[model samples]
Target chain A: MENRKIPDNKIKIPIIPVFDPIEELNMYTSLGSLHTFIKGSKIISPGIPFYSIIYLISGQLEASIVSRTGEEKYLFEICKNCIGVAINPNDDHEFQITAVKDCIVYFFTLDMMVEILSQDANLLKKFILNIVQKVHYFEHQARDLYQCRSSSRVFSFLYDLCLTKGKRVNDHYELAVENISQKMIAKITGTHPVTVCKLFTYLSREGIIKKNKKVIKIYDLNKLCNLIADEELTY
Target chain B: MENRKIPDNKIKIPIIPVFDPIEELNMYTSLGSLHTFIKGSKIISPGIPFYSIIYLISGQLEASIVSRTGEEKYLFEICKNCIGVAINPNDDHEFQITAVKDCIVYFFTLDMMVEILSQDANLLKKFILNIVQKVHYFEHQARDLYQCRSSSRVFSFLYDLCLTKGKRVNDHYELAVENISQKMIAKITGTHPVTVCKLFTYLSREGIIKKNKKVIKIYDLNKLCNLIADEELTY
Candidate 1:
């Protein structure tokens, strides 16, 4: 391989403000194309020669992978201005992406993406931040899903929510839970609704977590983390 | 937030050949400082207000995080020319990096690293590939670790190896396993070495995996994947 002659770019890297993927998409319009999908259409599936990255400009997408038993394992959702899928051609893992609502998407071939990103520092920074954030998210999900105990799994999920979404308030973490509920938590963790309620009480009585009208607070993160290893916790 | 003005660098993006991190590190010498740590010294520790990305230029380091019970969970090792730690200032998680051998390392404040990377498309691409590869590895690990059965955990480990290192033949995946052993498999999966050997025989008899003197072959990836959900397989 020939030596890569990199010229020194003396420009100061500016503080990146809020990200706007749509704005970035406009710059490379000549190199890529925009496509639309109606609701209930498959956007991406396994073994389809996928190597490009598609960014959602509008609507929503549900990305999943079929497990060995042929069950769809929900990976994530792609909302407006977010990445729909980024696949390396050499990777062995396969996933399916479907449109949950009518969507407008932009496709950038991997080569073109690399070209544009390598040329523009700000664009590369936004892309890196986006992927790094996803890495952080999957890390948290893996930790929670790896819990052996069922009830502890739910607690791990809450702990993840606190670490990712809750803010440190004085001595502990506090999160406004106005948008999340027990039923939603159950659906995610596969625990029964009754069991999720019981485990919440268990954590509340144990001083690990406190639940109020529209907020959930963590008094001891370490204690909640420890409960993730327990076989079971009785309320 | 204002719209970013991106210039047209008519220079075609060159094909990225083999990565040379040391070459990349040399270009950014002014942006970072190099330091040496003797064996047994801690490079990163929890609660030390860490926010930098260190590149290992020499020797080895072990990275770990203390679980809630104060036991160390081994994360990964840092060899030469690899990132020892990349901590974002806003992230709440903490980890400890320790020198297993006397090491020379380069420190780049997260800001400086980002600055340098954004300025060089080639450097940024390498960094993205590195992090994305880590994401792939951890996802494989999470899948294997999520398997509840002990024997199946070992199978999951093999399945991971197959997916990562094995090459596809006519219909099966074949891996040269001269380096891995039953003892290593048992240590990783927390199963007995005897159990590991027995499980190998069970999988072989079941027509899922075939182990030879220096190689392991998988006839059916789906069958092996399905076995990860099993309660147990007796040889």
Candidate 2:
């Protein structure tokens, strides 16, 4: 792929911005307020005034959108160094963010961030790139959901989780999903709880995965990827 | 909604950026190049080097992503004042943009844009907000595709079109979806081509919409919105 020649006039931009958490903390400390929440605490909720860009300094969080009729759609999980934006300040917030574990978050007011960004063009570009990267990520995830079936959706979600947050231990990879319930997983995968339970049982029986408490261990990463591949082809 | 008071600490930001075509043209003129394409011409293609931010100055275009196996997925339609981003510089572009009508587009190199943005923070904020808006739009569209049936999806698409681009004529709204065929509509709605044809015929017969050549006139916008409402309830 590197050997291919691109046209000289065609310019390239970074799809996503890279941020060091420690550096981000030092930069924004003077302008923002730091807040800490214990596990299972709501960080932002619907109908609340939310205008700041919430930066996850450490720990994990889950963000979701709730419809007017109370149907909750799980959006995505936020790991460290991720930024979350609420599009409007006046409208009722259709989304909520909650800490899945004890977390350190920084609330940078939009005005202050704008004030600071007005002087630093490079930082602003990085900010824009971060948002663009998120847009691409959501677009891809939505496409997968629309095209793949229930089983494949579950498998794909697991495969992505392993790739992003998995820790390698010898030949296996382990992920601490931590407090994410079967129902939440079902919501994320667009599958039913029963279906998720069934799939897990099947995988366990096949010795492909072992779930002990909040952690899931994948014995063979290649096997799981192959399953997703087969599912995609079959669909 | 306006009666509600937000907390003092909460500072609002615009949900979407506002850009004037004339203003954008002037800004990019010295920094980038202007290009024009005839209807049906390809602006971006797969395996081609594409790196700059493409801004639509006038006219319309359709962008789609093609899989390695040649399966094409219609992504979105680009209208005036919209910005298109090619996410990665090194990877083969999975998407292509084609002119739906004779279009004037501006190409801004990433480096040039970065250099200019580094001097202006408000413009940078607007740029970031624009990408975030696109992200939210795609997310909503994907949700509709995932949750709604084929017929509902088609209706929802039409309803949204009328709301956004529809021009008022007498008591009705008309949308000039010129050059957009039933097949394209099917791709956008995630329905079969035959299904789109059947729905159009049914809608025409029911007097909700009147189709003459490539133009569609919505005689009863309320009825169309109601149809989508009913579909949601039934589903």
On residues A161-227, what C-alpha lDDT tens digit does candidate 1 reach at each position?
A: 8877789999989988785678657645546679888898888888888888699989999988888
What's the lDDT for residue A104 in model 1?
90
Expressed as tens digits, the lDDT of each residue in B114-162 for candidate 2 is 6766666556555655666666655555565556667777887788778
Q: Which regions of candidate 1 fall more than 4 Å away from where they truly are?
A: A1-31, A90-92, A159-231, B1-31, B159-231
TM-score of chain B, candidates 1 onward in order: 0.62, 0.72
What's the DockQ of model 1?
A: 0.15
TM-score of candidate 1 versus the correct structure, residues matched by position = 0.66
Model 2 compared with the native: what TM-score? 0.75
Q: Write the per-residue lDDT of candidate 1 for residues B1-235, one digit (tens) a residue.
A: 1232111111111111112243576667667888999999997776565656788888887766554445454455677787743454433355678997999988987557767876776676567666655554444444444435576777777887787789999989998878566765664454667888888888888888777879998999998888777765556
